[model samples]
Target chain A: MKKRKQRVNSFMVNGLLLFLCLVWTVPTFGLLMTSFRDRDVVSKTGWWTVFTRPDQAELTLDNYEQVLSGKTITLVDSKGNQQTVKGDNLTRAFLNSLTVSIPAVVIPILIASFAAYGFAWMDFPGRKVFFILVVALLVVPLQISLIPLLRDYGRLELTGTFLAIWLAHTGFGLPLSVYLMYNYISQLPRSIIESAIIDGCSHFGVFWKLILPLSVPAIASLAIFQFLWVWNDLLVALVFIGSKPGVEVLTQRLLYLIGSRGQDWHLLCAGAFISMALPLMVFISLQRYFVRGLLAGSVKG
Target chain B: MAGVRLEKIEKTYPNGFKAVHGIDLDIRDGEFMVLVGPSGCAKSTTLRMVAGLEEISGGKVLIGDRLVNDVEPKDRDIAMVFQNYALYPHMTVYKNMSWVLKLKKKPADEIDRRVRQAADILGLTDMLDRKPKQLSGGQMQRVAVGRAIVRSPKVFLFDEPLSNLDAKLRVQMRVEISRLHTKLKNTMIYVTHDQVEAMTMGDRICVMELGRIKQVDTPTNLYRYPANTFVAGFIGSPSMNIVSARLNFDGDTCYVDSQNLHLRIPDDIGKKVRQYDGKAIYFGIRPEHIHARETNPEAADNFFNMEVSVVENMGNEVYLYFTPGNSQYIARIDPDIPVRSGDSHEMWLDTNYIHLFDGETKENLIYKPKTQ
Candidate 1:
């Protein structure tokens, strides 16, 4: 009787969860349908109305191919003279996103984990003051730095370069990354680190061989956050790399799709998917660590 | 193997809290020295200082004859087992044991040989392929010891390594660690808050409190001759019954007076308390020394009139919670000596073994008999 009762309860919970899931998935279904339909169908009828349309007639990968294969171009003027944009294809923007995100995520995490370890274990002059200062930066909106950072980058002739955006994202993301990693790393057993030291590991050796390995869950989770943040970011790219075509990220490319041609809705879905693909992979791979890391700092036996 | 010597060691944190005051201890080569105390008593801190994990605020720590104050923890060549086992969670039991050897760049076969040897000794051969989480608490603890064993360091530090295990397993691991000490015969410093662990394993025990060493002696000596009231009370379970009393010494006969009991001093040893004439002191004796009057009529030093308040029966012995006159104390009695709450009874005081401490300072005042 108890088992049956629990089963019913679980079934109710699953039903509610599926309902929530469908609520979330509706827009995604529309976008998917929008990407497949001709541009006329996307703006007039709801994408769900294509349900009566045959599978072959409704969904097509042609929008995705055009975006991925760098075939589509945007027309600049209504005189019907087409200016090649390559923005609709998403290839350049996708490559730019990888370039910006890979280093932006890696640099801050590497530096933040070191800072976290130092704050967690090492004793040094002004340790608390430095950590407090870093933590204080978390409250500063990233928008506040956009103009001043761009001005500084322009002086260095760095604005519109990938380096400018990478540096901006790292600076903006570091405080929270350090805070998260510190909370996670500090909760690790002091004994484990001490034991490694006693087992003939130096301080660096302890961090590398013991702490870094032990903190993989925390690292993976933080990487996921930073990766997704930099991947989906357009404002930073716009302010910094907006003038630079070669370095324009997918978020920028998607924005250009709207600004240049108000009617090219097909590229919107393809661009969204192109921008989302890496983050989806990252989220799936590191999702378990995300749950584990969040719980580890709060739960104790 | 080399003995560890701490001369006036101290540890003071930056917050101006002193966790370990100046302490002197000489742990003989190959002897297991246990530092036992209540929590926050600096025993763990002292052990960490020895392992070079904690820096001494003042004083010298020497292993064999070399001062190690400036040496790095890794260079100190010490092994430690932590309270929670501290086995690397990511490593298999075999890898965990062999990691230190591998770090030292020891040859693969030699590392394997040492790892296997430790596993055999710990009965952990079958568990080698498993990670720490895959094994039980006791198994994880063995792997911790195995980690220490493979290093073959000159000193071993154990910081409550068996504390996480269940009761039955703690007793079993206690014996195993003791046996490991005998076989390895390296200088070992084990820290724990458990008096039982201190009693069964230590060759010499250092009792600490707050930030100072109260006493350092063999477990037998510590139990018999605790330097102060705290050591006497802290070292034993059921604790020594300490009651406030007037110790009257009229040069010949020594007597202790309290509202609830009048206890005669036993022969021979009474001479020491005899000098404490007209002085207030704490009269102390272990519960097991106190026996039931009905079963042990001759066991009395002097008789106390009281009713039993409670009784706890263990298979071989009984713990009697009794109040004689108005003083409350526990008297451990033989199993056959039956008494329960609400029953009027008398329990004897083996006066010869009685301990006396200064009423104000709580410093021990009586001289203990020489050990056999």
Candidate 2:
């Protein structure tokens, strides 16, 4: 009876999970299908219809090509005037996003790992109080700091530069980054640090040669989070960088492609998929660092 | 190699929990000193203080003649093998062992040579390229040792380095470490809660309890002449049996009078303990000193019949546990002698090796401190 009940429970659980997965993925799958179809077909028919009658809708690469190549497309205005518009392409914006995200991720992790090492191993007066203060900063909302920071940035004439966004992101990401790195660095067997110390390793040497290398999993995992956040962020970019073609990130570019009248909404399916591509690749490739216990054989079982 | 001296060294945490209380010990040059005790005994804390891993709250620690109270661990010139091994997971065995040399800006060739020599000593030459995660527990422990020895530091400190291994492997590593000590000839201090390891490896064993040193003596002297009831009960396997009894005078002969039996205390031991006449005292004897009556006909006194409650047959010898006078005691006897649970048998206590302790202080009445 127990065996039968467990079997029934497991079957129900698997069915529920399968249902939830389909529920979550179906819309994204629909967008992917629509992204491949020609703009006219996308507007006239639902994306799911292509799966039923494969020949009903034609798949073309024109949407992606136009979005990527930055070619100008001619649009007839409502008053019937021909207006030549530069295509809302992500070519420059993609590079802009990389510039923003890479540094935003690398800067915080470098600073945070050092802060974490100090917090975890080095003994100083007010160490606990200082760590608590850093942790307390986690509760302070970024929205509250945005205005004051932007005001300062304006006075400093630093607005509309990648440096502005990088600093803003670093400040915003630091508390949690330090907290995550601290949790990983502190739990490392105290003996390893002590052993290093006894083996003639200076404090800086221990941090550089020991703590940093052992912290790859933590740094890698945090990189994925910070990179994804910075990549998808629109509010930060809009406020700091504005709609400057050269400095705008992918998310801002995608938003701009929606047009002031929302007439360009059709292009969104392809635009959104293009933005989703890198984060998907990032998550898949860097996900293995989440397989914890890199410390497995470093300490006795 | 240089000797280490701890002159009234102490450790008290910020929370005011005192871990080590004014511990004073001198470890001779090139000597192997083992600090052995039960859990919470502060043996590891004492060793950490010597290693400069822990801050000394008071007193001083000197490496050779130089005071190291404020010195950093690296500057103190010591290498420690921790209980968990603590090998760097990201580094290979060779890198782990050679890290300190590289830190000191030693030439690449010298680092390579020293690492290879240490690895060969630890039998880890073939495994040098493998990461810590790829090695087994014992192999990781060897690599940890290799990391320590590569520097050839003046002192070696070990904190229960074999406690993580299985029993057989622990014994193997025990011999291996002793052999390493013999080969290195550096002043070494080791800590463990295992008395057997203390006996087998230490040139002198320092027994501790409740953050204070109970006794420090050579292993043979420690076993034969434990300073107090705690050390007596702690140093030996199967432990010494200690029971409370009344010491009485019976017309020039003295005897221990307990619930189930009365036995004369030999004159030499009696004279030493006679000061406690008519007073409650602890009667102590080791398991090996208790024998089957058939095997020892010479000891006509101190024989009592106990129904054997448990019989442990250890092939060459047997351990028999029984209760007499409501106090449990173990007796080690030849396995060739037949003994069974629930069977009542006569056993003889060799009064020659018996110890008497003052009940209040638990200090061995017959203990004669070694004159240094």
Candidate 3:
């Protein structure tokens, strides 16, 4: 009876998980199908219709090509005025996203890892208080800092550049990055670090040769998080870099594709899928590290 | 290889808890010195101070003739094997052993040669490519040792290296480590709470308690003549039985009198303990020293009858637990002896091997051997 109950319980759990998975994937699946369907069919019926009326399974790359090439767009500015923006620079916007994200991910992680090693292992005055201050920053809302930072960036003439967004994203990502890296690095066996020290490794040598290599899983996981965050971020880019045609990221261009009236459904579907592509690939490729890194220092190997 | 010297070394934490009192010790070159003590005895603290892992709150630590108080662990040229093995989980055995040489920028061929040599010595040649997580506990421990061996450091410090293994494996590794000491011939300072390991592996054992050394002597002397009651009870398995008693001298002979037993002290021991006459003293006798009267008829000098409360058959011998008056005592008798709980038997105490401690100081008054 106990075994039968356990079997039933596990079956219910599996069923619930399957239900949740379908709830999540069904909309994405619809968007994917609609992105491939002809524009007329997408307008005429829901995306599920393609499955029943197999004859309407007409698929084309026209929407993608149109979205990728140049096209006019309408966007609402911060002062609540609608403006007509020219040039559908989707490829340029995609490159802009890459430009903003790569450094935003790499710089913060590199800096955080160094800071984490110092905070975790190196003994110096005010180490504990400084670490506590960094951790306390985790609770501070980023929204409060945006205006003051943008005002300073304006005065410094740093606004509306890829550098501004990169700096913004790195500043925003640093606290959690340091916290996560510290949690993982601090739990590393004291003996391993001591052994490295005794093995003639200086602080930088230990960090570069030992700590960094051993922290691949953690770094990969953090990279995925930071990349996806900066890639999908529309607000930070709009605030710092603006929706100017050439400087705009994929997410900002994606909003431009929607237009102010939200009537370009077919183009919106295609552009959304295009923007989703890189992050999906990244998450899939590094999903293993995600789980391993989360569990890294929680248990002893 | 270089000897290690700790001169008046001490450790006091920031919170002002003194973990190690002022200690002076000289570990000879190529010697295997074991620091044995119970938990909170600060044995590991002293070893870490010598390794330069812990800061010396006071005094000096010298490796050879060099004062290493300000030296970093790497510059001190010493290797240590931690209790948990402390192998880098990500690195293969070869990389773990050769990382030091790589850090020093040794020639590629020389690094390879030294790593292979150390691996061969540790029986880890075939496992050089395996990561620490891929190896078993013993294998990981061997890799830790191999990492230390590749450096060929002046002194090898081990902090309870075998305490994590099972009993059977612990014994096996104990002998293996002893053999490693002979083969390497480096001055080694090992810290452990197990006196058996200290006894079997150490050329000399330093017994400590409460951050103070009780006695530092060769294993035989430590066992035969412990300086105080703590060492007497700590060094031997089954422990030496201690009971409250009074030593009285009737001018002709000296006798130790406890509740239900009156034992005449042998002349050799009595002469040494005679100064404490008419004073309370702690009587200590090892379990093996008490025998069944029937086995040795010559044990007639100090004999008594008592009801056995418990009997443990250990195949070769039997342990009889009994209460004579208010004190409980254990006697190890031959297995042939017919002793059972609730049964009465005649037992003889070998006064020649007895230990008498001063009631006030708890210092061994009967046998005070010179420490080496």
Candidate 4:
């Protein structure tokens, strides 16, 4: 009787997980199918109908080609608003997103790891007070600072450059990054740090060689969260970089696609997937460290 | 190599809790000194203070006649092995051993040479490329030791380094560490709560209790002449049995008189113990000192009837537990005697190996301080 009950329990758990996965994955699958069909067909028929009427479904790579090759497509909105926005430059936007994200992730990790080391191990006056202040900054909303920061950028004459966005993201991303990194770095065995110190390693050497290498799981997980946030962020980039040509990110370009061509499901679906490609690859590659980092400090050897 | 001296060294936390009292010790050059006690005895704290890992709240610490109270751990020229064997989880055994030398900017060839030599000594050449996670517990312990030995520092500090291993491995590593001490001859201070490790490994053992030094003596001397009740109870396995008794005199013969036990004190020591006549005292004897009368009937000066409550059998020996007076006692006897629970037997007390402690102060009445 006990074995039978356990079997039924496991079956229910598996059935629930399978149902949830299908619910989550079906929309992305539908978007993928709609991206390949003709725009007229996507509007007339549901994407699920392709499986029923395979012969009637019109699949093409033209949407991806046009999105990537810089072809201009004009669309008319409701109430006859005609906007002739260019359909190309996503490749350029991808590069701009990289330029914004690489430094945003790298800069904060470097600074936060140092801050975490000092807060965790080094002895100084007001150390506890300073660490509490950093942790307290996590509750402050970043949205409230955008307008004030933008005005500061205006006075500094740095409104249109990628530097402004990088700095904004770094400032906004630091508190969480420092808190997460401190949770990990402080949980490290105190004896390991003391052992290194006795091994003739100065504090800087210990941080550079020992602590940094041991903290790879934490850094990897933090990098993923920050990278995906900056890559997919529309508000921060729109506020700081301002949709300027050659500096606009993927999210800005995707927004422009929606604003100008409200009915072009083919173009919108293809563009959304293009913006998601890098983040998907990143999450998949670092999935191991992500799980380990999340479970750290809660479990012990 | 250099001798370490602690002059009234003390540790007090910011919360005003004293972990270590002001204690003095002198570790001579190339001596293996083991600081031992039960948990919360602050033996590890005292060792850390000498290594500069812990700040000494008061007094001075000197390494080889140089004041090191303000020096950093690395500048003090000492290496420490932690209880958990804090080998870097990321580095290979080779890197873990060579890291200190590299940090000191030693030449590449010299670093390689030293690491290889230490690895060879530890039989870790085969494991040089493996991370700590891939090694067994004993192997990781050897790497921790190898990490210390490559530095060739002036002194070595070990904080319960073998407590993490299995029982068999603990005994093996205890012998190996003792052999390493003999081979290197560096001034070493080791801290452990295991008396077996202290007795087998230390050139001289310092027994501690309640943040104070109870006794410091050789293994034989510590067993034969423990300075107080605490050391007498702590240093032996199946610890020495101590019970409340009274000293009384019938003419010239002095006897330790209790509710169920009456044993005479030897004449040579009776003169000293006679001072405590008519006063409450503590009567202490070890397990091995209590024997079965059949084993050696020739030297049975003090014998008593005890009903055995529990019997633990070993292949070579046996342990018999019984309550003869107010306190329970354990006797280590020959397995050939065939003793069982619920059976009453005549047990012999070797009065020559007994101790008498003052009831109020707990200091052994017959303790004679070593002049050295």
Candidate 2 structure lDDT: 0.89
Ranking by lDDT: 2, 4, 3, 1
Candidate 3 runs further than 4 Å off: A1-5, A37-44, A51-60, A71-89, A291-301, B323-327
* Clash total of candidate 3: 1
Model 1 segments more than 4 A misplaced: A1-14, A52-62, A70-88, A259-261, A291-301, B249-251, B298-301, B324-326, B368-372
Residues B170-189, candidate 4, lDDT per residue (tens digit)? 99999899999999999999
The CAPRI-style docking tier of model 2 reads medium
lDDT of 3 by residue, B1-372 (tens): 899999999999989999999998989999999999999999999999999999999999999999999999999989999988877766778888888888888999999999999988889999988877777778778888998988889999999989888899889899989999999999999999999999999999999999898999999998899898999999987788999899999885899998877899877777877678899989999999999899788655798888999998999988999886678888998898788899998889987899899898999996776754
| lDDT of each residue in A1-301, candidate 3, tens digit only | 9999999999999999999999999989999888887767877888887788878778888778778876545689999999976565589889888988999999999999999999999999999999999989999988899999999999999999888988899899999999999998897778778888888889998899778977888899999999999999988998998756678888888887775677677788999999999999999998887565432221134
Error of 3 at A259 (Å): 1.8
Best by DockQ: 2
In terms of lDDT, which candidate is strongest?
2
Tens digit per residue, CA lDDT, model 2, A1-301? 9999999999999999999999999989998887788767876889988878888878887767777876456899999999998765687889899999999999999999999999999989999999999999999999998899999999999999999999999999999999999999998889888888887777898899889888888988999999889999988999999877689898888887766777555567788999999999999998998888676778876
lDDT of 1 by residue, A1-301 (tens): 9999999999999999999999999988777778787666566676767776555345677777776776466577888787876534577778888999999999999999999999999989999999999999999998888888878888999988888888898999999999999998898888788888788877788888777887888899889889988888878888998767677788877876654557777777766766777899899988787556322211113
TM-score of 3: 0.93
Q: Is candidate 3 or candidate 4 better by DockQ?
A: 4
Q: How many residue pairs clash in each candidate?
A: 1, 0, 1, 0
